[model samples]
Target: MLARMLVLRFPKEVVDKPIVTNLVRNYNLSFNILKAHIFPRKEGLMVMELRGNRKDYERGLKYLKDIGVKVESIGQGIRRDDEKCYQCGACTAVCPTGALHIERPEMEVVFESERCSACELCVKTCPARAMIVMFDKAVELEEELA
Candidate 1:
């Protein structure tokens, strides 16, 4: 199985269409929408995790592009700077995915990257500024796709 986080931008002309539904029915892909903002007759933006077989995934992406959806990979990921973290547990409170949590018995903050959804809540809630967003990969991928 192949899974990727994607940011999709829809032009105003295609904003009202059932783009996601088509992906599921026609492309045989599954998606988990992390965020979306769409208004009728206006441009739309969505952040989602799309999962499928490698071939089907590629086909789905092509379909999106053919329909005027600008698809971008969320090549970026979150990293924790242990040097900057004070283990104060401030980030744990806002982490919706349990990516940042205090370990039992030790009372130390642990960061589980696999569970992270790149929501950035830990980055915002951390008083010590420990959580960092890495953007280099995203920039490279965007440039290559463009």
Candidate 2:
């Protein structure tokens, strides 16, 4: 199955539509909703992981665009500043994706960009102001490790 993290913007006009349901029923795609804010008559945001056949995934994405949904990939938005972070583990507590975790032996906080959903929980909860959110996705985790 092809899996990807996506940020879907539901316009006010389509806020009440069954767009997600159609993705499952019509395109045979499976979705895991990571975070969502859906209010009636207002634009909504949804972060999710979608998995399915490559062909079906393409069709599903096309359908979303055709129906006026603004779709964007969840880029590498979660950033950590090593110089400022103190390994407090506060960010780990609120992270729903477990992208932030503590290493058992050394008691150090670790970040895995691949697992991040970019819900911005860590950014808000970090007391050290080390966890930041950015829009670039070009950087790889291995490069940071090096």
Candidate 3:
């Protein structure tokens, strides 16, 4: 079996297609949609975890690309700007993956990038404009660096 986190960008033309259904029915794959922003007649975006047999995974990916769905790995993730942040813990409230949290004794905000889902909730909830997305790997910074 194979599993991967993929971001599928679909053009407006194929917005209404039963692409995901076809993957399950024809390719014998399972999906967990992590995030999506799709609307009819508009460019759509979907981030999901796909799991299936090795051969089926390969064939299904090829099919996705062949049908105008732009596929990319979810290597990029969330980051925090320590200089801009005040450790207000506002972002922690909106973080679904518990990537952002508050620490005791010092009232510090610690970011566990590994637990993040790249959902962008922290970005939207942050009033101080402290959190940002890193378009690479999501790794927690050392205390001295951050």
Q: Top model by TM-score, which number?
A: 1
Q: lDDT order of candidates, best first? A: 1, 2, 3
The C-alpha stretches of model 2 lying farther than 4 A from their native spots are: 136-146
Model 1 lDDT per residue over 29-146, tens place:
9998866778899888887889999999999999999999999897758999999999999999988889888999999999999988876668778889989877654444334333
Clashes of each: 0, 0, 0
Q: What 10-residue stretch in candidate 1 is worst by lDDT?
A: 137-146
1-103: candidate 3 lDDT, tens digit per residue: 8878788889999989999999999899999786777888998878787889999999999999999999988665778888999888999898877888888
Poorest stretch of ten by lDDT in candidate 3: 137-146
For residue 60, model 1's alpha carbon misses the true position, in angstroms, by 1.3
Candidate 3 residue runs with Cα over 4 Å from true position: 1-5, 24-35, 41-43, 48-56, 104-107, 136-146
After superposition on all CA atoms, what RMSD does each candidate show versus the true structure?
4.3, 6.7, 7.3
The 0-to-1 C-alpha lDDT of every candidate, in the order given, reads 0.85, 0.84, 0.82
